[model samples]
Target: MLNLFSRNKQLLDEEIINWIFDSYDWAFKQFDPSVFFEETELVLPTNQYFPGEQNSINGMANLIFEQVKQHAGMTHWPTKLLNVTESEHQPVNPATLSVKGQLRGKQAQASFELGSSVEALSEDTKPTETKPAVTKATSTKTTSIKNNAFDESEYSTDLNLVMSAGHASEPNTGNNSINFSFHPQQLNSPEGLIAHFAQGLAQHLVSAAENPPPGGKEYLPVATELMGIFMGFGVIFANSAVVPRQGGCGGCGGGQSPVRQVVLNQDEATYALALFCCLKGIEKKQVVKHLKKHLRGLFKLALKDCERRLKQESRLSLSFAS
Candidate 1:
């Protein structure tokens, strides 16, 4: 998965991370995913700052930015705009406060503020209690998933797809889980998954916006996997859904836009889907013990934020049934 998500292609800015959590918070309030599966359109309360849109999930990238800005309370955030405040805050020397230096400093600070939330989350998720050693069963599962190689060939056209619901309690007094998996494929590799990222995002977003995929009898389990991949660490799951891809940067990059270069070919999208299935198991793995402290902060903030959202919502049956 690290190989798939790959190198430093711009860090997920702090604000974007916050928005992701907020989206989770919103979904949690409606029910940890009942609403996600039930409704195609996502809406949020309107306020002076971030008035979420009627179709927040699948809108044109530019328009969504306005909604995100409003929600982040950073509507005044600059776009191709600059301010003067050289590196030292107060220019190292009054004479050094040239327009260029001042602008650079301000720009740096502005960018820092933008990513504050992500850093905060990273800090908060840091480990507190020491984690127990990985049990043999857990280690075995990890090895099996990673060692399974993809079927790469000219004739390998079919994806090995499986979807089924867990057996319900015979008494009908318990819930069941859904499981879906695909035979490992080339696209699940570092090179292939990276190649399909852009196209997969375009397809997913467009499908979500213009025409949602048919659900039929397979909806619940499939939807659960999608939500988990998206909400969890998102290594294999960070679809174009990335804020920058949504045009969140202050200014557009020059030269041919990457979006224009990639043709949204169906083959590529299909490949990505296969990879998504193989990567779906990432959600269940526990964080590595050594790195748990670093991630604890993120877990903490996400929980705190969800709790806030839950508080705003009416109490659900489970909360008060006792």
Candidate 2:
């Protein structure tokens, strides 16, 4: 009967804890552990990490994307950005002022005649050569499409067509471009945008892995969320995991509730964050101030739990080695 008064101390289930450790080990193996041990920095929401003005949504998204890419060590990957809106509305095409750059493997000079219609003519096919309107040449082989106006609807369709034609024309040159799409609402929430970008990039990293995660394909989403934490965006993900929602009473403030938008819940995300901090040897004081008021206690609990767990693992490993 005395056991009824005893408190259960574990924050997460045993299964979840094992999955977190196993997935983290997989990530450590996939992306060099040396980098995680010595290089990766915990990305904060302050201007020091995300400097500059928040003037345009696209501009801001691009800036954040670059920062996330740099922190995640994915700077070398070829990528394209697309701001996708709701599908119901008619999407206008951004104005394409110019298209310049050489096609891969073909020495043919192509000219685009633009006025009422757009046409592409090769040097070998055209009898008369007209001076190109806009010509921007680059040493690297890339198709540059400059848009005076930013529009998502037409741009998505046009880019797909261009990419498809390029692939059809030259199938040997592998297309390695990754397109990242953002919703219109994401611009308002910086932390949400960061979480989305981190997850999107993490998905790419997972897809490129030689083997599946610890629990296999079914746990892909959970693993991806954890991988984002491993990429140094744990603070962002943890804080933005649960968002408060107002009831349908409008200004009456009658029915207020909390909604879980992302895959990981508050406890899971906080525990993962604590795991990240503990593994990196980061002190709790450095991270506590950044978390939500309620989560601060949970984070502390998670930190202690992670530390104890790691110590046990270390002891076991030493015994096995001996």
Candidate 3:
């Protein structure tokens, strides 16, 4: 069903792949390798389409996905996830006022205080009608951001609404699988993607703590590992179609070119990785070197695949010979 000639299809596939890689990379970085290397066996479902099969585009797609799984996998998350909570404190204060007014025949007066504090924590007695009631509240929100820092609370009256709305939409919890997705727009926001991935890690921590899978290990922060993941993903899919588009220049009056290579230059790709690392809370010089080091064999593999695809396409004339 995938046709490269169809521009829309190509774009959609590219867009989906881009986000998948980002999420996979993030999830992988948070994974602890010890779980995978443990004595237990990891039985990955076997259903990959072999790219070498004759006229099998599905095989190629499956191969690409498998490569991504291999490239992105790192550790086994615990059955439970860590707890990262955000608390809101809404403190309301009100002072009552009384006023008397004269009517045409009889004097009438009414006064009331709106938004009076509702003290729910203290065991104090209520005051008389002459004084206004007051309430006090203290709250906290803890999450694994900026090195598990304690950030400000966003308290509100509708705690449920605020809690659910502040974070990204969660995946279905009924199924025993880690599944999440992103809109094309969200892929552009590395910060949001990182946050969502952190939420996933929190889920894993909670699962681990609650279930305690066999040989499950303690959870720890892996900022550097995350950075390395970004580097790998950025370098591998630097030309992500999901990134926001800017003005593109061709001839002022000319029509579109039949073939256009919109790939980023080397320097541009490098800069993009650096920007992502800075955003992800890693701004060290070694980041780039680490990417280069891990990427030593990437170009070679890419070249081989390109050559094979070129040969395959050249030999095919739409269908197999009778």
Candidate 4:
């Protein structure tokens, strides 16, 4: 009975566990191992990680995008290739018009009427002065940085790897530019926006792969979410996975329901986060406080499970030889 209980106590099932492990291994093979072992820091949802205030919504979104890109280890990614715009549905504001005609002259009056009509059309076509909402940075040059620690032969052979700013270059995606449309509601929760940006960037990385992840097409979304976790944004992802909605009126009998934002559920995200902490040798005390109150217990269990699994398999250990 005790053994059965122990077996059932596992946080994730065997298939999910294998998939996570396989994904991590594949990531190590694709990108630099130092990213998982040394370079990538466990990002937290705090002012220390994201600082600065942009009064306008567009400015805040831009700031978050840049920070997420940096944390995902893609600072070398050309800013010109990406565009960020707010998704809004607003009614068209038509301009008012008034026309007056006088029956006094002949050809000259007709020509004057034509000229007035043309001027009115031009005035109507003039662009309106609205608040800046779309944020996109343009540059003619792409910067590349070289790292002595990176090994060329070890990574994927399908695409040419250009070492850039201590990380890999942004994947070449044909002619289409990457665009992120964020809802204005996201500004209320910066963590969710960070998770969204991380996942978006991760999708770009996943697209560059020669082959699909372990489960192939069907699991692509899951793999993309995991890729975000693998990119060191696990904390933000886990925290933003499920957010409680504001309750409605008491008489209406409406209760609070959590909004599911990411593909991974709370437990899965926390487990993946634990896997990250385990491989990176991050202690519980370092990351536990940042997680939600309800998730702290599960995180502890996940940490223990990850530690046990890693002990059984020595491949993920980090013991450098002298």
Candidate No. with top TM-score:
2
Q: After superposition, how far is residue 311 of candidate 4 from its true place, in Å?
A: 1.1
Kindly list the per-residue Cα lDDT of model 1 for residues 46-151, writing each as its tens digit.
1222222222111212233333323222233232110111122210111110111111111122211121111110000111111111111101000012211122
Residue 276 lDDT (model 1)? 25
Better by TM-score, candidate 4 or 1: 4
RMSDs, each prediction?
25.1, 16.0, 26.6, 19.9
Tens digit per residue, CA lDDT, model 3, 1-322: 7676855222123333243234323333333323222311211111121112212222222223233333333122111111111113322223211112210011112222234334211101110111122211111100211111111121111101011113232222332222222222222222223333322223223222222222232321222222223323443222221222233221122231111111333223334343343333333433333232323233333333323433454322121121
Greater-TM-score candidate between 1 and 3: 1
Q: Estimated TM-score per prediction?
A: 0.22, 0.66, 0.21, 0.64
lDDT of 1 at 74: 26
lDDT of 4: 0.55
Model 1, global lDDT: 0.23
Q: Candidate 2 lDDT, tens digit per residue, 1-322?
A: 5686577766889898878877887876555565666667887755567654433455556667777777776664445555555234322221111223321111323232223212211111110121111222221123322221112321111111011112121111222234455664555455666777777666655644556788897776677778889878898787656543332121133221121136777678888888888878788888876665667788998988877777778522321211
Candidate 4 stretches greater than 4 Å from native: 1-8, 79-177, 247-261, 314-322
- At residue 54, candidate 1 shows an lDDT of 29
What TM-score does model 2 achieve against the real structure? 0.66
